[model samples]
Target: MEFHLEHPLSHSSLHNDDADDNTLPLPLFLVEFQHMPSSHYFLTLKSSASLLSNRNFAISSITQYSRKFDDPSLTYLAVNYLDRFLSSEDMPQQQSKHWVLKLISLSCVSLSAKMRKPETSVCDLQVEGEMFDAQTIERMENVVLGALKWRMRSVTPFSFFSFFISLFDLKEEDPSLLKHSLRSQATDLTFNLQHDIKFLEYKPSVIAGAALLFNSSELCPLQFQCFSNRICQCTYVNKEELMECYKAIQERDAIGVEENEGSSETAVNVLDHQFSSCGESEKSITITAASSPKRRKTSTRRC
Candidate 1:
């Protein structure tokens, strides 16, 4: 969709002196930004996860079977499948998480081999670190195709980024400015540095939402308000909750001293060790989702 910066005024309003005195023209940027709401973010995120899950299943299977004899172009092939899979909205949901990832990855490698080097066969994907046998990969591929009903197209995050970027009237000289801004916001989100929002798990959808929000704000103040409003309307999450999460991030980053003296590597290792203890079992997840049936599908797709 193209974003236009034109404002529409009624001829009657132009003729009426009282109307001119009482009404102010709405900003074009605000009008456009307000076209969609915040809930759109959640919806899009859910869709992305569902689509990516299939690709992951495909990739995993190919890598497992092709082990030591795996094709060199498998990675490229898998990524291609991912791109194609996410380009449309009709992707299907698979029952097993592992299956989805494996199938997508395998499809990617297969396509890559066909296009880049026709001599490459499916047997070439069997390399170490990837332990799926050829039969397993083939079975998973069949299962994925069935689950997806052969409709693999999906709209990926990259497309959303391009669409959102086009909404602003940025200058050529400041091309990198947007990237820098996005990077800064992402860093803040990841480290919990700028706000109280502490995202335990940084998913693609969350990143996309943050990127869009930050970009829109830079384009115009009204855009920020409208975008924020739209987000709220579409999502069950309230502004206050998001703000609180941002606040938690800020608080976490404001630590005065380290708990122990160690090198950076040691510090990272220690942190990882501490956080690794917080594991959740599949049964626990099932029980939790059961309590909130409305979120069951969402949790499965995302997790």
Candidate 2:
């Protein structure tokens, strides 16, 4: 889906469950992410225990497997499924063979594609020289779903993007167009940063905020100061913490986007970020950055 800055964002698509104008608080989200099914699911090389080397192998295999599909989102989603599944379950052989992990990677990509957008035609078992029969792939998918508790709608950094972006007074022709640009940049950074465990420390909302901040610095330098000031005024976001997260994100990308206390000179407004079941009391936190047209190579940590 193209993220148009000017495109109108529905609460359902942007928020988790058609959340109202008063979005959920960041603290609540942090707490939920900590315990929710997803909180346990991350794919850091070190987090793999003895599977460190094998984790790298899986990354390589999945990267190759991703090429078989036309949509990149399928790969990203499949990676999420793979990481989550690995978090709670073990390989059938438990590191007895390399092909086992490769099979898992294949199953993940295929299952992700099927879950996200199932095709009417039977899936092709062969990608390259390797082949996974339908039964084996289905068995793996069942294991993955069980591990994830069938929670396919994984809450991601993208979930909090709309609330954070709403804080910015980005009035333009079809704000959807601009929103898309910002969302696209943020999505790219999120995908690259997934391999690192450092990001897992922060809530997805905070990470989303940081991504928007970096995108703002890169794409909307002219309004960077204004955006920074407005975002800091948010009660839910500690200015220091958000800035710290933003710095980490930039360093990880190695793109070197600088942050300045620029101008709180811009008028700050309190946003009632009322998320689902978190109560309507939490109010007034804004975090959003405008989009940029330029693209830069992200220094992703391989392996």
Candidate 3:
């Protein structure tokens, strides 16, 4: 990757004439970048002492490398680990940004596989990234964990899935499948939108709890009641705001239904011409109460 360096180092920006000032002065390198155009400025300053040549690549690579992991929780872990490692005194000064990023990505996958699927070994991860070797990955994992002080467990996607499940009425077995589908949808949705959906923005723990409650038919009512009580206690969002979101979702669903109906009619017309002699055999689809939509009021328990 080619990097353009237009501005040379200047001493005037570095000197603090105020000798009386007790605070340590800002670095000259930072001041130089501050004067440069936004488009020209790089995130990671290329220090002659450091092994990393391209700082821009370092910042950009982190984002690109993270997508390979595909799991949000794992990506979050990698990001946190990278940030913590960079801030720590023990971080290898000689290591390139590319190496650091690669190491963190490897560590995240290793940790995730261990936690989520214990049966999967380190070799599995190596195979996924054809170019990367297992030994390099293992070494990086140790370094990352040491830098993080081994405090890895934190917010996760499963927790969020569980919380959302609690808000709806679903079976125990239903939740597992629902969680899988929701996670898959969330992955695709995030990629296309590059933003988190409002409905999926709750804390992972809350979401996991909610998912459990939603999945169990026996527990859903109680869970919803508890959620309602908690919402009343919390001042973050009022009842009006909640109702507005619900209304918006309903309108969107209605529009989708109209589109589907038009498509169905078109399909039926195409089939009619193909099988004209058997037209009478085509049964009229009657939507009964079992198939028809039923209006259910959003229940809110008083605090």
Candidate 4:
């Protein structure tokens, strides 16, 4: 999807007219900066256990709600908004108020649907006996827009999938089929890995490259090195960073594999050992989506 700045302005009136009228159009440079990864300040923010747990709950809530719409793009973008909002602003002591959490999830998903032009009804999303009125959701949408600086065009790993896939040299008669399958596999990996906070530390492009490389290792082991070399040689990709992300993904997938085989005890041991050896900065890494609990019911009163 091409992200022309004018497309967003044409579709949604969520940005306040007065505020927008007062400000000049965003410059190309500033717009490009939005696509970059999280800043060091956000990565180093001192988050308490409660804050991380609350964030995990909100992320899981958004994940569950978006799936109801049966749109992968919607789910991806909603979670992207949630993470970016949390990174930009600090939310302290928000765990106790479940309403605020539900509101955040709804607003993010609503905004994502608007941006993607998905056939989603806000009323239909009022799940688990919780109903938020359009006006209340609109208000929260404004909050999210302000926090995100009206930059709804999120640059996720999906953005680089095509570019990386183009680098592959498929010798088969039906390369398009191979490419589609490979892309699909990589896309699912990227989506599932988002729940792991450690993946957030890497840029979208790096994550995209790593995901592609990981998928290629399975689908085309013989050409894995070729794919890796091409990806690493790209000017936008940092070799060391990609390697770190790849390692983290491998470790996360390992735990999933162990758990699926009915070795819950071994999975716990692997998680503990990995966290114990990593530095203080890496301790924020949490469980992958494979072992995450089922999405709890959302219970917000009508707003």
TM-score for all models, in order of appearance: 0.34, 0.64, 0.35, 0.71
Off by over 4 Å in 3: 1-96, 127-135, 164-303
Evaluated against the true structure, the overall lDDT of model 2 is: 0.57
Rank list by TM-score: 4, 2, 3, 1
| Local distance difference test, candidate 1 | 0.37
lDDT of each: 0.37, 0.57, 0.38, 0.65
Q: How many backbone overlaps does candidate 4 show?
A: 0
lDDT of 1 by residue, 254-300 (tens): 44224211111111111222122225542211111223342221111
Q: Pick the candidate with the highest TM-score.
A: 4
Candidate 4 per-residue lDDT, tens place, 1-303, comes to: 423222333334544343332132333223434754356422332245555666667877897777777877777788888877766654444443667888988899988887775556787777777788899999988988988888788767776676678778778789889888888998888878776665666677778888987788788777877788777777666676676576556666865743432111112233332222334452334332232242111111111
Q: In terms of TM-score, how similar is model 2 to the real structure?
A: 0.64
User: Cα deviation in Å at residue 234, candidate 1?
Assistant: 10
Task: Please list the residue runs of candidate 2 whose C-alpha ends up more than 4 Å from where it truly belongs after superposition.
Answer: 1-44, 47-50, 89-96, 120-122, 171-178, 225-241, 255-303
Q: Per-residue CA lDDT of candidate 3, range 78-110, in tens? A: 443444455455654454656565556556566
Stretches > 4 Å off in candidate 4: 1-37, 40-47, 93-96, 257-303
Better of 1 and 2 by lDDT: 2
